[model samples]
Target: MDARLAPFATTPRLVVKIGSSLLVEGGAIRQTWLASVVADIAACRADGQQVVVVSSGAIALGARRLKLGKGGRGSLDDAQAAAAVGQIALARAWAELFAGHGIEAAQILLTLGDLEDRRRYLNVAATLDRLLALGAVPILNENDSVATQEIRFGDNDRLAARSGQAAGAGAVILLSDIDGLYTANPCEPGATLIPTVARIDDVAHMADGRSASGLGTGGMAAKIAAARIAVQAGMPLAIVDGRRDHPLTAFAKTGHGTVFTAESCTSARKAWLAGRLTVAGRLTIDAGAAAALATGKSLLAAGVVSVDGDFARGDAVEIAHAGSVIARGLTAYDAPDARAIAGARSDAQAAILGYAPRAAMVHRDQLVMV
Candidate 1:
């Protein structure tokens, strides 16, 4: 058992990344291994932890149905077709695997842009939050059917890290073909496993390229990159050997993993809002709103004096007061709606917007003081 995984027991929320090799073997799903994973998830849930799975197997599963292989699926369209067929099977497999545990599995497919765009990022995050609140496990994958080369994740490692950020996960675990990062490629003579990586640069030269499995894309290099992405957002990430059945059940007994410690301590969600987004619009609020916001309260429409620039709902916008920008957050309403409801009280919001309306122009949780 690796003592480093001690953090796993206390993680309030965790994102688990299962690569193609871990889930599929010889053109078929690894049913028994997947069942063990479900057991791990059920145990996590019992301990009151929220779980999100970022799994990769759709293309592999779809390829089998379409009789396509790496060489057979030469074109992007062909790959997309394979993914279209396999996505259904992949979702069904997860749903069925979790059925016995009395849990609902929610499928969420995304392109690279979904996380790159601030508006879509918020929408994705909200859905994840709601699904967890409803006690459902979210199964996320790259929308391979629709994703072109320009917008594809290419591998699930980085996607898992981003999904962890979006879900505000306390930690991320990458179940892999190999146990952990090695001092050198394990295939080389005298190469040894490096159990804990405190900094990526120190081990940057140790990265071995390409996956050993035909079903997976990411290799040790990719996992290193993933560790960089996750740790920057204040969460540790673990790369563990997952070839064995009931791996999670035996996690405490197996000390074969590379644990990456986070260098920063910022909340993943807040860090994204603080620096990653490009502000799309600005809202000038009254002094009252400024006062309320300083106390960590949500921005109400009644406190808004005016709206500037055009932005749709869920877009990141700056909140200003008396010509000074005080905070930035995702707006609940679009520019026109925000304008129409400016200075309007909650009682009159529906009449102003022609809908029941989402309360709070900007939620405090999403807001970051600048």
Candidate 2:
């Protein structure tokens, strides 16, 4: 594993997520800080690196602009209203900052469903790629105005991680209030900074007592969760203090953060599958079936030992072994169809089901090898 921080300095593609606390001051937008961030991003682009910024502060900006006190957590409707109001100012602030730097910034708002649906996910990825190709920096934010309980990323931390994965970024820099992960809160006795985290699981113990910042929904816990998502999607992540002067620039030159290296360089499809919050169902396969899948073959109905869970066609599902998940894919058939075809002979498929759409339960294009 190449764990050096310098790799981030020259990384061709980067995702930088700035927290609300860093972007707002006295309950209002801080144009100065936004300008500094834009300058750093411009410097990165000057070095030939493509950059994407996943930013928070819309809610804060909205709340301040509307003069709404921070007492609306009790009502979901009120919170959404704040996000709705803040999103505009947030985008405008970003646009104006980038304009000063002579760069065009595109506001790309996304919902959890956009990332969950394979087709839409790929479309968003393609659009972001095209924007980058055109020398435009894509400013990403969660679609809080439209997202609900079941389809929300909850905070910009996860959104940033997903953006990094979707953009195939080499590194994801999570700028937060704190410098990095520590054995304990650095303000407390016996606390020490943990410079490197080779495995995400290693930091689980350190995240227990951490709490969210007053200005942001995500705390250190969310940052760790985001790191796990980024690592699983084959991207390295660094959590550093955004409060520092030129945080991204300094972190790139010196290792002043908790660096989480990716486990492996998985393909984009597999990364998408791995990052999903839930699978629709499971397709159990025999040993031959598992081997075929491992060899990059499509999953045929004949190899399925059983199907479990209620799922519709085009929904994500898991391919399992004795117990563990071996793969995940978009099912070509609904639950009833899949259940009826499991363990059935290929020749008998049409006879039993009265119809068949190809023989495979999932085509190779829809399947992601675990």
Candidate 3:
């Protein structure tokens, strides 16, 4: 494997995105292909890797039931109707496929707002984290049935990118009909694959290219948009050919496709957190918590000595120690709740918040040391 591609191979947790074209053929589920992928995922889980699958195919499946064409119904209502019907079948297929490998499949549906809104984003992150911790493969998809066009992510490529962030995934894989980015459309002469993308903008001109298989709707442009989101969050995103059987298996071994490394985004993200977002609140931590934060640990509520400001769950807050701003990050709890839980014990958090799976005040991934 290429050293630049090492992170994709060694990531402890990964998000694999399956496009509708890869999952559905003429409106029916691709059973054999899906089974093979599930087997690979089971193997990954056995090796202590947590995997999340963000799939797109509900509308396609529903179109089959409605006798509609590959483009699905022309109107938004028709599309939503198809999604409502197809989502059930899609979820069922995932559950059955994973069940074959003795793995439980958990379905999670979300609209764009789920990831855009801080409070909802925290809830989603918590849910995804808990599902992975319980050793279950979470099958996530856009809530197309209920999502209005105004709030829709427009495509699953962006949805998968957001899901990766919500899941705190180490890397993302976009399984598409095309192998990866190319200098020109592969059909044209002198076209060649660009294996590693260090910066998305340099090769973004190729975004105008069409899908080679003509089976996918997102095209290269959508994938490029997805890569931007992934890279900005400091995650390596891989765009690989998924039309073939056992794509993940081959990808794990060879990684033969275009990968957006965005190696610099890790530091970039920290920089963004350290200065980009407006500080809505401030948290003062004890020396122990300050030590933990210095070592790159999450800020647990137990370590918080005081909370200032009326910030919401998703608000950016500063971590202060000894009258100095040590770090900054998105908060997981609201002002009242954080104030209530300040210095609270971990075991007693549930009792205090009256909720399950209360996360850190600031997760390490979002925490930026200053």
RMSD of each: 8.9, 3.3, 10.1
- The ten-residue window of minimal lDDT in model 2 covers 71-80
Stretches > 4 Å off in candidate 3? 209-216, 265-370
Once model 2 is optimally superposed onto the true structure by TM-score, how far is the C-alpha of residue 242 displaced, in angstroms?
Answer: 0.8
lDDT of 2 by residue, 1-370 (tens): 2346755776789999998888877767877767778889999999999999998887777776666777234356766777889989889989998998899999999999888888888899999999999999999998777788888888788889888888879889988888889898778998988888888777876774233557777888888888888888878788887886677777766778788887786777878887776788899999998999999999999899999999998889999988888888988899999988888777888887887556579988888865
lDDT of 1 by residue, 198-254 (tens): 887799778866888866778888887778778877778999888997766666567
Ranking of models by TM-score:
2, 1, 3
Which residue pairs in model 2 clash with each other?
Answer: none
lDDT of 2 at 33: 67
TM-score of each: 0.73, 0.85, 0.72
lDDT scores of the candidates, listed in order: 0.84, 0.83, 0.83
Which candidate tops lDDT? 1
Which regions of candidate 2 deviate over 4 angstroms?
A: 1-3, 185-188, 208-211, 283-308, 319-326, 342-352, 355-365
lDDT of 3 by residue, 28-129 (tens): 998999989888888878877899999888988898788766456477887888899999999999999888888899999998677766678779989999
Write down the TM-score for model 1: 0.73
